[model samples]
Target: MTHKILIADDEPNIVISLEYLLQREGYAVLVARDGQEALDTIAREQPALVLLDVMMPHKTGFEVCQAVRADEAL
Candidate 1:
């Protein structure tokens, strides 16, 4: 099955790299800069998986993960 992966990170290089790699693997890639954007994207798309960086702006990856896990919509 085709799956979508959300990559949340502040670094543009990291985002681009992950997108390229994951896309090459035939997965749809969605990018988010910083934790808030990541959360927003997750709420909007409900991607199959996520790659979150630990030290992001607005909120940390730890916070984001906790929030995502706590989200009933997920």
Candidate 2:
């Protein structure tokens, strides 16, 4: 089974690099530029794993993780 992954990072380079790497490894990859976007993507897509950066605009990775942890859909 292919496991989907959500990537939340502020840097475009990091996002692209990881996107390429994960995709090449046969996993479905999703990218988010910030924490809020990450949270939104997670809510909409419900990926199996999330790679979140600690520092991001609007909300931090900690906040996103908390939200995901609290979300009943997860």
**Candidate with maximal TM-score:** 1
Score every model by TM-score: 0.93, 0.92
lDDT, candidate 1, 1-74, per-residue tens:
78999999999988888899999999999999999999999999999999999999999999999998898996
Candidate 1 TM-score versus the reference:
0.93
Q: What is the C-alpha lDDT profile of model 2 across 13-56, one tens digit per residue? A: 99999999999999999989998899889988889999999999
Predictions in order: lDDT? 0.94, 0.93
State the number of backbone clashes in model 2. Answer: 0
lDDT of 1: 0.94
Per-candidate RMSD, Å: 0.9, 1.0
